[model samples]
Target: MIRLSRCAWPGERGAAAGVRRPKAAYNRGMSRNGRIIVAMSGGVDSSVAACLLKEQGYECIGVFLRVGAAPAAATDESGTQSCEVPAAADAGAAPRPRLRHGCCSATDAIDARAVAGRLGIRFYALNFEADFERIIDYFVDEYAAARTPNPCVMCNVHLKFGKLLRYADAMDAEFIATGHYARIRRDAAGNATLARARNLAKDQSYVLFGVQRSALPRCVFPLGEFEDKRHVRALAAGLGLRVHDKPDSQEICFVPDNDYKELLRRRRPEALRAGDIRDTSGRVVGRHEGVANFTIGQRRSLGIALGRPVYVTSLNVVSNTVTIGERDDLLAGGLVAQRVNWLTDPPARGCDVATDIKIRHMHTPAAGRIRRRDDEAVEVRFDEPQSAVTPGQAAVFYQGEDCLGGGWIQEAR
Candidate 1:
């Protein structure tokens, strides 16, 4: 289980800042829409979510997760926050790098607190550094194993939904909400289903596939109905919230500079040893600094003089070799995924179901057939051959906009 620590801001009298021990008499029945815990990242989307939930008569509590990123103070006058990029170390001093991001910074925590204050809601900053470090380790390990890792998906699965839900239960909140662009639809029978947001461009349903089926009913996504980010920003601006125009966080929060290789070098230098790069004919075409530096579909930076383009077709960590081949060599008719989490009822072994498969977050959903291999695995065969069926990435199964389930890709065939 993930453990958390709470930090109290100065001048807050009792408990952690904005946190109050629930009274024995206090109950969910006291609130109009019960109590909700909002994961506020000091971003405009989450700010708007808190505002909307408050407007809907729900008692809201805003939470900022501090995952070891350096916090910069929010500007006093404008109440705006920006990530503090660490300066290079002075001569003879050991360089200490800080995680830089507009989100997950101290400035972001203050911005969230300011919004919560404006909305007349309680706010708390939770320390998730330990849990986040595990994520960083996962990011590094996957690369070391010669596979691409989707840390965002892992974060959503384990931290945002998993640990945050555990916190909500402790707080006696009825729901846990986030600014993710996804929807939870309830049928007449009150069964919840996850779906893509109306704004397909901003849809985050793929990463959210790991949410436990039983927990779907209590998961709330307030920004799902917004047609676009502009509408959400406009709402925040109209409400006088300061983060209305804050740029969306694009890079992975921990790797703020987007230099994963640099992180790997610091965390696991052994993974960066020079290796041989070979082609399909088993001939050494070139040499590479590391197998971790290449992914299955990468075409650039090969440092080879091949007259035609060649893509990374495979990586053998044991042999310490990267295999490059023509684009057609990357195509695969099917893939096997393990650790499947089915949002709906698990399909019986040997049953085949038609669905759309998404291999990556930005990849378009493709027509496919999924067959249950066991309770925890499935074989997905695409109607048409797909390129770059990368292992260690998610293969989310969908039926239209509804997210049925997903799993981690194990291999391609």
Candidate 2:
């Protein structure tokens, strides 16, 4: 299924349209008139991206990265698909209903291949199981250590752009393109820079700051200029692509139900071990089912009564206790971010700079003054106290619409 081309470039109006720019960065990851490997996920956005690139005269190769096998049959006490099953007991006698999560599933790969065929382009499913295993290990380990982890960032850094870039090099491709809602452009100095998408509502620049800056030039984002996701769906539909009507994938690909606590319990049982629920004063106010069940600033669902509402303020791994307190306790004045990855040039140590910080993906940006610390750290002092400055979550720095960089929250105080 493909639509009549829109001719993004002059003289290019169809999938088989002749290419005019031989050295365009969008097609220059290789020697000349370079080939592009579009990372298709069986979703409309990627499908549209591949469709547009092919029409624009690039030699497009559609590749769906195979990250995992089908999850085995299992159910929770409620007979719903649950991540609680232990790793060893997952393979059951009965088969489970297929999950339509919009990730790199086998079904998704097949759909990607079909799109490639419709476009008259080469297609392949690249095995990335080993890469996914490492990402999962890092995800579980971060939780086991009482820190919040952004698996998407790690996956982008290590695989989507890292291993995938290597694969492109081996294939003699000029660039790697994906459906990420971010923009890439060059600066006056001829260095590539990252920016938010034209559609601010769908901007995904936060999760992509870890990308190696050098590789940014070889990255192509075909949908960045579109102001609405509906436009993309319309374009794909106009082209007769089947995924044009597909719903957006909401849950984490690995955790289909978004019940991360269940995944943690299954993979890292220690995180679920019973632990004391203490007050800020070190009083044993209650007991909780391990630190994994709670996160900073979380209220409700916490089965405790102290004559007043209580919120999870902190997690002490050494003491094996979850500290609960009043809502005010969740307010943190500042934070320290570790393992910083600067998309732009980094400031000198102790150099003060003003930037907005986003603690979580959905959080509103908080105005803060940040200063470089060690080689891989930054200190964020917010203009005003911010609540629930969570650890393990990323602290992305932004200067207006530009994505400066970000790092993991090491401590929130």
**Evaluated with lDDT, which candidate comes out highest?**
1
**TM-score for each model:** 0.84, 0.85
- What RMSD does each model have against the real structure? 10.6, 8.8
Candidate No. with top TM-score = 2
Instruction: Give the C-alpha lDDT of model 1.
Output: 0.78
- In candidate 2 the C-alpha lDDT for residue 359 amounts to 89
lDDT of 2 by residue, 1-413 (tens): 34233423323232222322222224333335558879988788898788778766788887777777634534422232312111211111122334567486555666666666667777666666767988888888887888878888998899889988887777777689999888887766657888888878888888898898888888888887778787777665555566667778887788767788888888998778788998999999888887877788888888788788889899988788899988888888899998888888898888889998888887878898999976668999999999999899999999998888998899986
Quality of model 2 by C-alpha lDDT: 0.76
Alpha-carbon lDDT, every model: 0.78, 0.76
Candidate 2: stretches off by over 4 Å? 1-31, 70-102, 305-309
